[model samples]
Target: MRNFKAFGHVIIALFIISLSAWCHGQVELDKAPMEKAEKDALFSTIQGFVGNWWNGSDLYPDPCGWTPIEGVSCDLFDGFWYVTVLNIGPIYENSLSCAKNLEFRPHLFELKHLKTLSLFKCFRSQRRHQVTIPNANWENLAGSLRSLEFRSNTGLIGKIPSSFGVLKKLQSLVLLENGLTGEIPPEIGNLKKLNRLVIAENYLSGHIPDIFTALGDLLILDLSRNSLSGSLPLTLGCLTSLLKLDVSNNHLEGNLLKEFAYLKNLTLLDLGNNRFSGGLTLSIQEMHSLEEMVLSNNAIGGDIRILKWENLHNLVSLDLSNMGLNGEIPESIIQLKRLRFLRLSDNNLTGNLSPKLSTLPSLNALYVSGNNLAGELKFSMEFYGKMGTRFGAWNNPNLCCPLGAIATSNVPFGVKPCQQQIKLVESNTNGSDVNKTFYSIASLCHAPNHFWWTFPFIMILFLNSYIIGL
Candidate 1:
């Protein structure tokens, strides 16, 4: 009986040990496996762009587990770890920095699951080491990428890659502040899912592709600071959901299109510093959702009364400076209670300003300089003080400050006080003696201590003396 009890105890101890070992094996099996192909591709990509000195195996062995690369993230797909994000720039502290001779490796596109790839301020302008974006293989990332950005890379020169259109899943495509040249390719019209397309501050030229109509879901489309020309496409109206559209500082021309009114949701419409000519379009009155409208530095000539200024009730900033505008500033503009910055300078405007402008709840900067405005500014002392130099009513030869305004009001810059007209008497005598008498009489009248009561008496006496001598 004692031997049987001992045997049972031994059997129980063995069973407990076996169960513990099995649980340990299960834990090991649950860990996600890193594929050898993915690891090799990732290492080669980093080596190609960040320089060959980086050895991922020696520095970060388990890239998805115990050790991780900065600016790199991963996801598990079908029990294997895959890289889903790779950022090459100094955006974060201790982030991977691009080498001076950065080159795109084939392995980069091999990152099958990459959803976001950003390179910011990495390629400083070095002509000898200039590199263009990969001309092919972008289709590999088209299946999974959601965002791609290349910002401020001056050395990354060349025309924009047309293969970028293959990124069917891309939502945001930003290539701002690069040295890219050549016309924007029309192939980008294929990105029907793209919402934010910003290609500003590049040397891109040619007409804004009318193909933009296909991007119905686009929200922000900024092509500003490019050398693009041609009329703004009427097709832009198709982007019904667009909120901001900036194409300023281009060589575009033509009359303001009626189609612009169709952008009912657009909050900002900046077409400034272009060559667009013609008077204000009748359709502009319907852009009630516009919060800021900058049409300055164009040749848009018309009076303020052409359109009912009261229609833009949501306007906060309105810049129409240097656009050859003439005529009176209508009182209807004061209906814009939200207006903060109003610029109507450097034009041929002729009129008296409305004191109601000061009453605007948010009026901060008011510029009416370089016009033909006349009459005294009647803004409140507080208004003048608060605005100070922000009120730029200068270069108007006929405009003047209110009486006694200089003492209290922060008089609008470059304005003069209204002066009383002084009439001078003409002498009839024609000899040198007559000239001498006139000079003496004028000097007496101008004397600082002269009495106003004696001025006429002195002038008459001098005239009579001159006649007697003649």
Candidate 2:
């Protein structure tokens, strides 16, 4: 009886083990195959790029040792798996100057599910030489890509591939600080999904594209420091969503367009160092959100009165230097309670310095040099001394000597006498002899050799005056 019971117990244990194995198989089968393949590709790409030393650096969790890589993520919806985002910038290594030799493991393109590709510092190609990014490798990339970032690729040279515009789903494109040369492709305007586009610090040349005006969704646009030339398109006003617009350091020219008032949401507008000319219009005051404006080094001419800065309460830095401005330093600037740096130098401004400038609680740096400003440099100098600030107003020829004390270390005392330390008795005797000679000369002019007559005439005149008084 004991042997039969022991055999039954063994049978039950075997049955339990068999059920557990079947359940594990079901769990494995439940995972989507396509998703798994995509994850594997992502994992391989990271490992190949990061090298063996970074096999498992606690970046992310992966059950199959292939799902998680740093800066890489995948999403699955409705049983369909796709790479929703890939921010593999911080992990890419670029040692070779040639971008082609930068070792971008082509396997990354196999991630057919990729939607966002951000690989900053990936361009390793040297100047003038075209580094061929394998366009074929991206052949299988899913059509869902929405955003792409390739920033800080200083060595990157070559035009953006026309194929880039084919990314219909692309929303935000950032390719800043590259050595890219040539004109910005007009096809870029085809990217209707684009909102924030930045291509600053490149050697790009040519006119601003009117298609950019069609980008109503564009919120932030920076095209500074390029060799781009031509007039700014009036269509720029169409960007109603623009929050920041920076076109500084280009060769662009033309008068300030009134259409600029359309960018109502603009917070920071920098048109500095361009060839833009003409007078600043009252329309500039329409920018309600303008916080920092840098129109320095342009040929902008005008009165500060035309600009309504009441809306610019948040202004922090205002630079209008070398713009041929002529006027008094506006006391209205004192209303900018948040101003930190104010530069309005190299202009024709003339007026007594604003005392309000010294009293501004937040004002730190104020430069108003190379102007017709004159007055007692006393007010300005005393203000500087009180604030412990550096003052510079060196070259106003009309400015007088006391004010010229700014150029001196110390003020000198009274001038020294030509004859030093004559004996008192000798000086008195010399003075008396000089007085006698003076009287002799007076007598000769009145009447030659008539000293006695001169004395009598003097006495007679004194007596006549006394008689009249009596």
Best by lDDT: 1
TM-scores, one per candidate: 0.83, 0.70
- Model 1's alpha-carbon lDDT is 0.85
User: lDDT of each model, Cα atoms only?
Assistant: 0.85, 0.68
**Per-residue lDDT of candidate 2, residues 91-147 (tens digit):** 535221223334456768777667887767665456543354444544455377788
Shift of residue 368 alpha carbon in model 2, Å = 0.9
Counting only residues 3 or more apart in sequence or on different chains, how many pairs clash (N, Cα, C under 3 Å) in candidate 1? 0
Clashing pairs in 2: 99-124, 99-125
